[model samples]
Target: MKKIYLFLLALCWAGVSFGGDFVVIVSKDCPLASVSTTDLKRLYTGKLENIDGTSVSGTNLSMDNPAAVSFLSEIVGMATTDYKSFWLAQQIRGGSTAPAVKKSVSDMISYVKDNANAVGYVPKDAALDGVKAVEVK
Candidate 1:
């Protein structure tokens, strides 16, 4: 029983540590072509509003999405709970609300398609017809 429990614990940790690839995306009309990790973090945390003179708004998938899990750990360099807590504190301090959350990949993609300033991430192979992948620098 103990061995089974231990194996399950290891499996969950491995899932978080070894999440799949994700790509940041924006509407094809966005002027910016790429973004730095530092700036990407700042944007998500609401410390930034524009990149290279173009106004930008960041969005995230709902907390449960695997792609969001990957984005937080890999690109944002934050654990899920820590990221949630940071946004909670930010709101308590009267700072901006956290980025909007889309409930599904289709919703996220549709949002970016409709909002030219929106930037978001999804599973690497997710359909990206009206959106263009933004290189992470």
Candidate 2:
């Protein structure tokens, strides 16, 4: 029983240590102001056509980061492997291209803030103001 309890405790610790955080950001004046989980998923998945009544577009930072992966898995409800496969299939099908992927968090934040209809995700601790944080369910 002690050994089982030790193993469970270690597992919980590892989970907590490995988890990452991210924030979905939009311009302060984005048309459709707030976002629910459904809205966010729609926007990220290219299912939504617009933001604040205008055409919608979003960008994502490099997928190699933990925070980026966490956002996809936790907020978007997509496992890492499955998400990669989905993007790959989209590319093969020539579906509406994926979001313009940024190389760094700063670049993503800059692009989203400068483009009225653009949205993107960054680390939760990224220091930027005037960008609205969309709460994910």
Cand. 2 TM to true fold: 0.75
Highest-scoring model, lDDT: 1
| Candidate 2 C-alpha error for residue 54, in Å | 4.0
lDDT at residue 93 of model 2 (Cα atoms) = 88
Q: Tens-digit lDDT track for model 1 on 17-39? A: 34457889999889879898778
List the candidate 1 regions with Cα displacement exceeding 4 Å: 1-20
Give the per-residue lDDT of model 2 (tens digit) for 14-74: 5433345877778877765556666667777767867556777867778897777887886
Candidate 1 TM-score versus the reference: 0.84
- RMSD after CA superposition, every candidate: 8.5, 6.7
TM-score of every model versus the real structure? 0.84, 0.75
Give Cα-based local distance difference scores for all models.
Answer: 0.88, 0.74
